[model samples]
Structure formats: structure tokens, C-alpha cells
Target: MNLVRSELLKIRTTSTWWWLAIAAFLSIALAFAFNAWVANETLNGNAEELGVTGDQASAAAQAANLYTSGQYLGLMFVMLIGILMVTNEFFHQTATTTFLATPRRTSVILSKLVAASLLGIGFWLVTTLIDLAAGAVFLSANGHGTLLGEWAVQRALLLNLLAYAIWTVLGIGIGTLITNQLGAVITAAVLYLVGTQVVGLLFMLLSNLLNSEAVVKWQVIWPAIASTVMVSEGQTDFTPAWWVGALVLIGYAVVSGVAGVLITRRRDIS
Candidate 1:
């Protein structure tokens, strides 16, 4: 309990928490802009570009999609929060003092894992509230009406929170495994922002060359897309079952976390 409290205190005392507020602002602002644009399209009778067939139901669905899509942009910020939670400790050479106080390496790592996860959830909650508020106001102003009651929207929102929380833990694990702060941070960014897209493109090229539908299904196993599959709720046919996608995501967290714990336990802190 003390270790957890200490970890939380470390985060509280630092400037890192500011990123959460920034993420919330960006998320809400972008969501509002996107919703407003969709509303414009709906009014201009060009909603067909977004697959809205000039019907109330389809328009509501399209609006819901636009509203939720912007919230995912905040995930990158939360991912940075996770990476910095541990990487910062190493960057400042504070891990030696932290270990001296705690003595037990496992306890220290576990506390960080807990702290990062909680912080991640908190970040998501704030971002989600902002998204809802901004989405409702802008969407209603644009005459699109709020679709907060839609199950798909609700699922996407909740799953988005879960995904971000897991990402923080994954960040902790990666930070622990790779002690180099810059390397760990850059690796996380590349994996999430660029690596996944590259993998998808490569897979698509291969799928075309091989002419197999199965290749598309294999894409679901990638952590980034798996998280999307868990939240997208039947909107995309290429995704696997929700359970399968969730397992794939959990598998990533577990593998990275376990590897980190093992390395932390065995490595010498200089």
C-alpha cells in the first residue's frame, strides 16, 4: 500500500499529469469539429459519402461514428502517460532511490503497474466526459441530435476506456523491460502510431497477392486492431469475435508485463 501511495505521489508531484488535461481538451475539441462537419454533410444532402442513405437512422449512426472516433485520438496521449510513468524514473536516475526505499523490486513494479492503470482509467474518464459533452452540444447544434443511447456508441466508449487503461500497463511493462527512456518512448510511439499501419498495409498487399480472405482475419490478432475490434461492435466484418480480440489484447499486456517483471527482478540497478 505504501509503495502504491508513493508511486501516486510521484505522479502527482510531477508535471506529467498536465498531459491528461491536454488530451481531454484535444479529444473534445476534435469530436466537436468532426460532429459539426458531419452535421454539415447531413444538411447538404451529401451524407452518402459517409454511408448515410438520407435516412434518420443512418444519419444518427453516422453521427455516432464521428463522435466516438475522435475520442480514440486521446489514446496516444494516454499511451505517453504510461511510457513516462516508468521511463521518467529511469531518465532522472530516481529508480535507485525508489528501490532503496521499497527494497523489493516486485513490489515496486506492481505498484507502478497499479498506478499507471489507475492513471490511465482516470485519463480516459475525463476524455470520455469531455467527448460526450462536446459531442452532444455540437451534434445537437448541427441538428444531428445526440445518439448517446445507442448501444454501439456506449460499447465503443467503454471499450475505449478499457483499451487505454491496458495501454498504460503495457507502457509500464515496456518501460521496465527497456530501461532506456528514449528507446522505450520511441518504440511505443512507433508501434502504436506507425507500426500497426505498416503491418496492415503489408498484410493487405500479401492478401492480394495470395488472393485469400483468411489473410484479412489474421489482421485481428494485431494488438492495435484487436483493441478496435473489441470496441467496434459489428461495424467491421474483418474483426474476430469480441472475446478473441479481448484475449489478444490481454495477451499483449501479460507478455510485456511478465517480461518486465522478470527483467526487473534479475537486473542490477546502478
Candidate 2:
């Protein structure tokens, strides 16, 4: 209990978490606004192309405004937060003190994981509310105001939150195992940014060059591929089923976390 309290204290006192939260909130807000704007523009263009004017075009635009922009920005922020959650300990030399104080390395690591997960969940909840509210307002302004049921919205929001939180915890595990701030940070960044996209492209290219349909479709089994599949809206025709994606991601998180624990327990922290 004390160890948990200590971990929470460290998290609360740090400025990094606050900065990340602010950045996440702002980024989600901007993405939603941009998506809304683009939606309105496209709808208007379509309306003009079809020779439809006024309220009809506005209504069409509103309906088209339900995009996945909020998820994109929120995920980016999640990556940043995940990187810091692990790296910050090294940057501040907190790990040494934490281990020395706690002695039981597993306890310390578990405490940190719990703290990070809670923080990630809290941040996601707040940002989701803002994202949904802002999206609704923007859509309503354009004359397409179809309010989603509270329960459905809440469920979607929770799924999003879980997805991000799991990723962050997985990152924490990576950080613990590596113990080098730079390496862990880079890995987390790559996982979120470059890793998945690179795999997706390579798979597509290989499929084109080799004329192999199975290879192209099966490539989504990679960790990066699976992560993308999990986050995408409503499973595109090319993407894996949502349950497969979810299971793959969970597998990655579990394997990485266990590996981290084993490494941390055996390592000489000094």
C-alpha cells in the first residue's frame, strides 16, 4: 500500500503528466475541428456537384461529419504519454530510489503499472468527453444533429480508453525491460508511428510484386498491423476482424509485460 502511495505521489508531483494531458486534450480538440471542417467542405462540394443547395447540403454535411479523427489524435497522445511514463523514471533517476525504497522490485513495477493505467484511463475519459461534445456541436452547427444514445457513446469511449491504456502499459513494460530512456522512448514512438504503417506498406508491396493474396491479408497479424486493426472504425474490408485485432494486441501487451518483469527482476539496478 505504501509503495502504491509512493508511486502515486511521484506521478502527481511530476509536471510531465500535466503537460501530456494538456497536449492530449488540445490535439484531440484540433483533430475533431479539422475533421469537422473537412467534412463540411466535402459535403458542400458534393452538394454543389449534385446541384443541391442550402439546407439539404448542410444536412448532408452534418451526417458526414461522424469521422474517426478524435481517435487518431487521442492515440497519438496516448503514445506520447506511454513513452514518458517509462522514460520519465530514467530521466529523473527515480528508479534507483524507488527500487531502493521498495526493495521488492515486482511491487515497485506493479505499483507503477497500476498508477500509469489509472492515469491513462482518467486522461482518456476527459478527452473523450471533449471530443464527443465538440464533434456534436460542430455537426449540429451544420444542421445534422443526430444525438447518439448515452450508453452507446459511453461504450465506444470506454473501448477507446481501454485500447490506449493497454498500449501505454505495454510501453511501461518495455521501458522496465530496457531501462534505457532513449531506447524505450524510441521503441514506443516507433510502435505508434512507424512500426504499423511500415508493415502495412511492405505487406501491400510484397503482395503486388509477388502476386500473393494470402501474404498480403495475413500480414495484419504483425503487432503493428494488429494494433491498427484494433483502432480502425468498423473494420475495413482489408483489415482483420476486430476480435482478432483485439486478441493480438492483448497478446503483445501480455508478452511484453512478462518479459519486462523478468528482465527487471534479474537486472542489476545499482
Candidate 3:
């Protein structure tokens, strides 16, 4: 409990958390505006031009998208926090003191994971409240029924929380591997922002080359796409089950967390 509290205190004392939170706040607001517009277009019979059928499935999918829309940037911010959670210790020269206090390195790592997960939940809750409010207002104005009553919509919201937590774990893993705070953050940011796009393009090219949609199933193999899959209602008829996405994402987080702990135990901090 003390270790966890210490980690939380580090986050609270830093200005980084609030800066990221502000960025996340603005990102969610923009996402809701855009998604709400899309939903309105779909509901108002602009389906054909938009490639939607304006059906229940489409509406539910859009609602799920809107309900958890903050995830795109939210996960990124969580991951950065996770990275800083560890890298900050090293950067500020507090890691030695932390390790000296808690000689059992494993315990420290575990506490960090717990704290990062809690931070993720906090981000998830804030975004969810904003999303729900925006979605409710948008739906009512459009004369569309609420998908809040639907299980799929609810499931997406729940899974979104899971995504946020896991991303932070991955971030901590990155920090553990690369203690240079600036390098770790830049590496993570580039991989997340640019890497996802490049990966998507690669998948598209592969699908085209194969002349088959079957290759699309493998998209979840990538951590970013796996997060998307974890929350999506459905994309195309071939979308893998949500649980498959969950498993793959969990696999990444577990591997990263485990590797972080193993390396930290052997690595020389000085």
C-alpha cells in the first residue's frame, strides 16, 4: 500500500499528469464532436454517402464508437504516463532511493503496475462521463433512440477501461527497457503515432497483394489494432471476436511487464 501510494504521489506531484490530462480532455471533446456528427449523419439518412446502412447494427456500432471515443488519444496518454512513472524515477535520481527503501525490486515494479492501472481507470472514468453526456445529448437531438440500453454499447465502455490500463503497463515496460526519459517517450510516441499508421498501410497492402481479406484477421497481432479490436462492436463480417483482441493485448502487456521486472532485477542503475 505504501509503495502504491508513493507511486501515486509521484504522479500527483508532477505537472506531466495534468498536462496530459488536458490534452486528453481536448482530444475527447474533438472526438465526440466528430463522432456525434457521423452518428447524426448516419441517423439522418446520410448513410449511403457515408457507407453506412443506417440500421440498428450501424447505429449501435456508432454509439459504441462514440461512447468510447476518447480511447484513441486516451490510451496514448496513459502509456506515456506509465513510461514516465518509471523513467521519471531515473531521470530525477529518485530511483536509487526508491530501490534503497524497497530493496525488493519486484515489489516496486508491482506497485508501479498497480498505480498505473489506477491512473488508467481514472482516465477511463473521466472520458466515459464526458462521452455519455455528449452521446445522450446528440442522440436526443437527432431523435434517435439511446443505445445505452444495449449490451454491446455497455461492453465497449467496460472494455475501454481495460485498454487504458493495459497500455500503461506497456508504457512501464518501455520505460524499464529504456531509462532515458526523453528517448523512451520519443520512441513510444513515434511508435504509437506513426507506427500504427504504417502498420495499417502494411496490412492494407498485404490484403491487396494476397487478393484476399483473410489477411485482415491478423491485424490484431499488432498491439494498437488489438486495442481497437478489443473495443469495436464489429468491423466487416470477418472481424475477430472481442475476446481474441483482449487476449492478444493482455499477452503484450504481460510480456512487457514481465520483461521489465526481469531486466530491472539485473540491470545496473548507476
Q: Residue 49 CA error for candidate 1 (Å)?
A: 3.4
TM-score of each model, in listed order? 0.84, 0.78, 0.95
Worst lDDT 10-window in candidate 1:
52-61
Which of 1 and 3 is ahead in TM-score? 3
Determine which window of 10 residues in candidate 3 has minimal summed lDDT: 50-59
Worst window of 10 by summed lDDT in candidate 2: 59-68
lDDT tens readout by residue for model 2, 114-180: 7767766877678766766677777677665644543333334545667677766776777766666
- Best-first order by lDDT: 3, 1, 2
Angstrom error of the Cα, residue 109, model 2: value is 1.1
Off by over 4 Å in 3: 53-57
| Reference-based TM-score, model 3 | 0.95
- Residue pairs in candidate 1 whose N, alpha carbon or C atoms collide under 3 angstroms: none
For model 1, the stretches where C-alpha displacement exceeds 4 angstroms are 35-48, 51-67, 139-145, 235-237, 241-243
lDDT of 2 at 44: 56
Instruction: Give lDDT tens digits, candidate 1, residues 1-270.
Output: 788788888888987678666766766676667766766776677765765442332545555555555545566666677678788878999988988988888888888888888888887777666667767876688665787787766766777777878888888887877778889878878887797798788878878899975677678777787776666544333445556777787898888778778888898888
TM-score of 2: 0.78
Each prediction's Cα lDDT score?
Answer: 0.73, 0.64, 0.87
